[model samples]
Target: MESTKDYRQLPNSSDHYCFGCSPLNPSGLQMNFFADQNTVISNVTIPDHLCGWSNIAHGGVLTTILDEIMSWAALHFIKRITMTRSMNIEFIKPVYIRNPLKAEGKVLEITGKHDAVMEGILYNDKGVACAKSTARFAIFSPKVAKRFGIADDNSLNFFANVFGIK
Candidate 1:
């Protein structure tokens, strides 16, 4: 297991205006995750502004959280940066905007050289599974990483620092 201190620390790039995990995005989810053994766990509070129906969180918003958590699980646990190739989600119950949600993800399997299968679940404050997702991720290459503005050396170091690889 990686050091707990390293797992708990957010990468410097985590603040890079990301809609899901950026702390600087006021309109973003600002989600924070913790490494749990080989998985990643996070709690998300749905705001009223993110609702699709009266007092209920939007399905799209929930999907984004699941995607983010699953991607992070792949990167942190599988030791690779990746982009989602496809994701399938299942909505089991309505997510209330007034309650916090628990999101957890783990790497299910590696299917190919650059592809992985990952799974995630979202649970309401009452611990009921409200949603779940599975996704395929394609490993990021230098070219694709550069196109996303994520290939900077400083950014790589930031990730390494957070993951305790250095």
Candidate 2:
């Protein structure tokens, strides 16, 4: 039975402990991403406790947000499991805490077998582009997924539903 879900999100797991995008992690960011065609988007509000300085969002957190959006983009948009290959980020402006931030990612190209290039950008509450990033990823094949122990029935089912693959 193919359960075709109308909406798409990065697949979740029971024990996912990712600080950037895990709903199960109590002290984590708990980011939720949505797909609009090939673009992956997430809205986040940086908390005061996550600041590096007096009121600025931590640079590591900002980079994590960028990495997450782009990684999720590769997952749902490419319909494949992947690992980030490399990332380059540029911070254009300081991000303040407790502000609505928008993170967006898109698939730039599929370079080779199970490999792709992706780009991401972060915008502040004032609609200013505060940061930008680009990266490459290694999408996994079935054999690789099995070897990595991430290819479970639940994940496959979730992917199938989101992608309408009967």
Candidate 3:
């Protein structure tokens, strides 16, 4: 388990988030990720209420976990805030709702300005690969940040803290 100091303690992104990554929304997944050296890892225990069919975890939920991890990994390595431009995922096996899952992501390659390719994997309690994902992210610039109505200084500071950037 990570201490609060080791985690990214920051405000939520927006008010309405059906996506699993946002922490502000009560119904969201509220998944938190931390940087471990060069990789980002998160442990999640699926709740019975979030199961899709029977006792299996929902596919959509699995995708969200992969997406979030990949995006965070990119931000950590690139030292910039970014948004996913494209993502592809493959579900290898069914994830059980009662079991704990571990997700990890790393930067594969950094393309020109604000562009990066990241890869991530999800493993079951037994360490089996349950799912995998790859994503392309575009880093947000000051101009883009203002256009999106996102707080530039606060958001950049959040990533800087995670990446240990000055």
Q: Which stretches of candidate 1 lie over 4 Å from their true place?
A: 1-14, 141-144, 147-150, 164-166
Separate clash counts for every candidate: 0, 0, 0
Candidate 1: C-alpha lDDT: 0.81
lDDT of 1 by residue, 1-166 (tens): 1223545644536438888998889998988878867778777898878999889899999999999999889878867668899999999999988687888899999998789999999988778899999999987654567678855776566656665432
Question: CA shift at 12, candidate 1, in angstroms?
Answer: 5.5
- RMSD (CA, Å), each prediction: 3.9, 5.3, 3.7
* 51-107 per-residue lDDT for model 3 (tens digits): 999999999889888988887677667776678899999999999987878888899
Candidate 3's C-alpha runs over 4 A off are 1-24, 150-153, 161-166
lDDT of 3 at 40: 78
Q: lDDT: which is higher, 2 or 3?
A: 2
Q: Per-model C-alpha lDDT, please?
A: 0.81, 0.81, 0.76
Return the candidate ranking by TM-score, descending.
Answer: 1, 2, 3
Candidate 2 accuracy as TM-score: 0.85
lDDT of 2 by residue, 4-98 (tens): 25335554655567898878877677888777676888888887778999999999999999999998888777878777889999999999988
The alpha-carbon lDDT assigned to residue 73 of candidate 1 equals 90
